[model samples]
Target: MPIFEYQCRECKKTFETLVFGNQEVTCPMCKGKNVKKLMSAFSHSSDGKFTSSAGPGCGSCSATSCGPS
Candidate 1:
């Protein structure tokens, strides 16, 4: 089983769920079946500390320069 974050399409609410085999997912707020999985941010733990994949803003951009884009 894996946890996934979802945004309800009907009520516009955000929620998380632990999905199992063939399990139906729905919003806990409005019980809406229409939902979309969000592009979740990733993180990792090292030496008992946590770090995010998208470090600080650091005025950095992958496809474009740090200027106004």
Candidate 2:
């Protein structure tokens, strides 16, 4: 039950899907077999705080900490 993110090289669309065993992955948008797995980041919360391996804030934004500190 491992969920992985992928980016379709043909359409340049990014998406996530559940993968099991040695099954092949296809782009949900264009159904293209030419896809590449992307490196994903993980996050968790404890003591009423949110933290991520991508550091503070969303990776695409400049805000410091996307959750309560």
Candidate 3:
């Protein structure tokens, strides 16, 4: 089974679901059927470094400088 993330359009709630097969998906918060699957990031650590395609800062800072110069 794969874990899928979904965001509710009705209540604006985010949640995850473990799907085994083709089935109907609904928001757990408001039980609304209007939901959209979100493209989440997968992370892995190798050679003592963390890398991801989500870029740096994760939206914390908008500055161009990264770390102490």
Candidate whose lDDT is highest? 2
Candidate 3 per-residue C-alpha lDDT over 1-69 given as tens digits, one digit per residue, 9 for 90 to 100:
587778899999987787678887889999999999887623531332333343654434665466344
Task: Tell me which residue pairs clash in candidate 2.
Answer: none
Against the reference, the lDDT scores of all candidates come to: 0.66, 0.75, 0.70
| TM-score winner between candidates 2 and 3 | 2
> How well does candidate 1 match the true structure in TM-score terms?
0.54
Cα lDDT of model 1 by residue, 1-69, tens digit: 387778899998976678888889989988879999876523531332222344443334454344343
Instruction: Count clashes in each candidate, considering only residues at least 3 apart in sequence or on different chains.
Output: 0, 0, 0
C-alpha RMSD (angstroms) for model 3: 10.2
- For model 3 the TM-score comes to 0.55
- Give the number of the best model, judged by TM-score: 2
For residue 46, model 1's alpha carbon misses the true position, in angstroms, by: 14
**Candidate 3: how many backbone clashes?**
0
Predicted structure 2: lDDT? 0.75
